[model samples]
Target chain A: MHGQPRPYWNPLVAGLILGLALLATFLVTGHGLGASGLSARLTAALGSWILPEATAANAYLGGYVKAGAPLAGWITWEVLGVVLGGLIGSLTSRRFRPKVEGGPRLTPARRLTYAFVGGALVGFGARLARGCTSGLGLSGSATLAVAGFVFLIAFFAAGFLTMRLARGAWT
Target chain B: MSFPFYDSGFWPALALGVLFGLALEGAGFASARKLTAQFTLRDFSVFKVMFTAVIVAATGLWLAEELGLMAPRSVFIPTLYAWAIAVGGALIGAGFAIGGYCPGTSAVGLASGRWDALVFIVGMIAGAAVFAWGFDAISPLYWAAPGPKGQTLDQLLGLPVPAILVAMIAVAAGGFWLGSRLERRFGGPIGSSDVTCGSEGAQPPETGTRPGSMRPS
Candidate 1:
């Protein structure tokens, strides 16, 4: 592991740790994990910065302003920790490198374009659904929530179909 | 009653998020190639890891509730909004396949200096802005779908928690077994391939190649 990056953890083991973390969060905070909510708040904050009156007038963006600073929420701090933790993990494993991730079939430009489109869709969808993979899928499912199971089924169905349609970009 | 430590704010949440990120990165979920491989049927690492985590957390939480260590009602439950959730799921699923990273994983990827992850993050914020901007127009359709608020699987099926837990465990176990077989057939061992893009003309070694063989000759 000196020159080369260390191999990733076994999936099962890493998953166990993740599960423990989830349990711990539930026990302590009386809530589960989330990602997209922070993104929404960030968006609201940005909107408020650009157009204070219009953003504050909007029902969704206005909520953040009413709640005070959008960035001063628990999820926002947790996301910041996520970035810090990821940096630590990557650095310790010697996997930190500036580059894009894509298959040989696609160029960096094309891959970035796809990434942006995908991210936008995720952002839009997460808001509509009220959560994301972490918030709705994992946390909600663990609690046996109906919405979680539904999201899981629908997510996989769309994912498989989309993957087939976009084969050239990946394969 | 004394265990939750709720009076202590932010620190616990932050610590848990860190651990969550670490587990994801260490499991190689931060890599778009590895994640997309799940959709391509080339690898099932994502499925295996996620199912395992779900089972572990579900079982543990149930046990804690049984022993009166915690109250189930205290946990935040997402309300059911049928059509919105389903459509949202479809959008997210398609995004995952195209972008190759989910919200949590993309953060890890960005932290590790993946340039594409940055672009994806920007896109996500923009998308959120778009949604906020169009909230009034979409809200009618979003709320039109009929569903019970905060319904659970056990409640929907009128099943006992123990029975549901058992069924979930079985399903997860079966999924893992099937995922392992799929990976064995369509893909190589986990983490055997490096997916970081290099200079133009550099091809990532084919799957199943020896780990060190990705280097240019």
Candidate 2:
């Protein structure tokens, strides 16, 4: 139901555009971009709804709940926009074919499993670091924050090492 | 209007998020294989895009502050937790290598109809829940070391802001130059063929198909 996929924009060009967006965000909002916070907030909110006692008693989830309504928070709205933007881009570019994407070495199930585990690790890691790529890697580092650079270096080094070990997953 | 307009300016934040997502998808980051290619040194889009964005945004922020266009301390600086952040970052990196999509790109991939990305998002939520439950164990280290919120790189390195900026710019430019060279030598060819999302026989693009490279040619 789609035509051939379009070629992606050049990396530098895309980066420049993205950088402008980040700058605009900083100029207007006085905060850098973020993504993983959404997951933490949602988890906190949903957990409290399902197990108010347990969630509130839990140190991490409890703090998130006290912060504000999860759905109405700043990053929540931003992430909603992220989904919408990607949807629009995919639709216009004709790249919206729904399927399990993976390297030649894996089956759909395997790919999905790896994706889930990887996502889980990132989720926990982001929470621990108090931010993710957009927050710590880009925004934090952009501000020249010490923590931001630490995260960037640590994550890249760990990622390369893990990728080497899991060569079978993609190679 | 005012700086740090989170309460009064959610609309703007949402708009910026869209632009961010669009840029990532346009860069082919909606594709997991395309993203993971960075680890293999087969593609450098991730490095190129990230550093470019950093350099541009950081420089712009510095200039704006200097010009008094934006109020100082308007931007929220993350607090420093040395041990927790380092360990957390390592975990995140391992996750990135395995998952291919980070939180933002996973959302983009899901938007583009990738079920794997959806699963990954779900996994993230579950992981967060686990972290919550395990907070007691991690809390000690999480709170072990803390720095003032405005712990910028210049302060950390004992270098002035301008010097750090200059260093960052040079490093990013050099990385881009090096990345292209690596891609030329070790990278898998970017595909011009029709991308198939088929089952069993389908392969993600730009993954090595050679003895150890990208997709089937």
lDDT of 2 by residue, A59-138 (tens): 77777667657567888889999999999998898778788877777888888899999999999999888988889998
Docking class of 2: medium
TM-score of each: 0.94, 0.93
Tens digits of per-residue lDDT for model 2, B88-145: 9999889988987889899999998888899999999989998888888989988878
Q: Indicate the worst ten consecutive residues by lDDT in candidate 1 chain A.
A: A1-10
Segments of candidate 1 deviating more than 4 angstroms:
B189-193, B196-203, B208-217
Computed on C-alpha atoms, the DockQ of candidate 2 is 0.73
lDDT tens digits by residue: candidate 1, B1-217: 5335453367766788899899888888778888888887767778878888887888888888888888665677777788898999889999999988889989999998888888888989988899989999989767866577778888899999889988987887898788776666664434723654352322455554643322111
Give one digit per residue, the lDDT tens place, for model 1 in A15-63. 8998998888888887778888888998989888999899899987899
Candidate 2's displacement at residue B77, Å, is 1.6
